[model samples]
Target: MHHHDNPPQSVPSSPAYIRATWGGTGSVEEASAAFGFSRAKGYDLVRRGEFPCRVLRIGRSTRVVTASLLRVLDSGEPEYSGTRDAHTAPA
Candidate 1:
């Protein structure tokens, strides 16, 4: 079994715009960046069942649905502050 004791792994931060173009399976950082949040925030959201479940895993990594993230962003209509600005908050 996978060790639940170990903290989750992280993905490299990719450009949000490019991530938006990816269409599916985004790294956690890519999704988080689209939401204008830190990777930690993304994990927290996942813990809270706010983000899409990981569609795939590579080694110690997780990949989320880019389409889901984009749909989320589109539905939320965030201002794209790239920070925790309530005005820029995702729907």
Candidate 2:
């Protein structure tokens, strides 16, 4: 028999969960990293409403909901279209 220290599990990261806890608002870095996007591209998306638009702005920070990102990923909604070659942003 084989012994395992940890069992396989499925779970999103803690920050991802927390950011969506209050509906929507993810740290720029977290959101960027979550979707394998660069900081600059992430900010641009935030501003362009390309991804899930930030529900609120707090001081100098912004947050994006994980749901918005998921929606774009999960569905083929025309509004959430992306031009892969046109932008160096990550998938």
Candidate 3:
């Protein structure tokens, strides 16, 4: 018989992990996880223009600005300015 004695590792916060891995930008999924939101809900928020920060649309790709995410995390208030580019399109 053999016994396993490995301890469980502590999980890092979503925002911290996203910031470390993605640097200045991250996907909407990452942003949603950072704020403890479901991926579906996150997409819904973006679609309804109710996301906490500005969501950028590049082609079919959607990315969240890390600066804005960090700001909202710090201040607990959204600062969206409704700056959608011509190329902006929903995912």
Candidate 4:
């Protein structure tokens, strides 16, 4: 048996679902899950100021901009970069 205080929610990687969640703001964990990374990696990106999307920080909490997340997903690119990397670059 397992007991958890706050269990992770299923975050669908759909634009419609994202647009409807939290009125345009989501937690770092949710964003990370959608991006296929661990929550710790997401927070590490935030701490290092390298997160792919725009973030709103207040006190000790961080929130990812829904629009930015959507942009990253829809465009297949990180918001911070104008050029694609080796994985996405042309041959």
Among the numbered candidates, top TM-score falls to 3
Positional deviation of 15 in candidate 1, in angstroms? Answer: 10
In candidate 3, residue 81 scores what lDDT? 32
Every model: Cα RMSD to truth: 14.2, 7.7, 5.8, 8.9
Model 1 agreement with the true structure over 7-91: per-residue lDDT tens digits: 5443334345645357567777767776678889977665444554333446787677665555556566432222433444446
Query: lDDT for each of the candidates?
Result: 0.57, 0.55, 0.75, 0.77
TM-score of each: 0.50, 0.48, 0.70, 0.69
Model 1 pairs in collision: 76-91
Clashes of 1: 1
* Candidate 3 ranges beyond 4 A from true positions: 1-14, 81-91
Order of the predicted models by TM-score, top scorer first: 3, 4, 1, 2
Output the TM-score of candidate 2.
0.48
Question: Model 3, 1-91: lDDT tens per residue?
Answer: 8666875443443455556667777888878877889999989887777789877878998788898987898789996634454555555
User: CA lDDT of 25 in candidate 2?
Assistant: 49
Instruction: At residue 40, give the lDDT of candidate 4.
Output: 99
On lDDT, who's better, 1 or 4?
4
Worst 10 residues of 1 by lDDT: 77-86
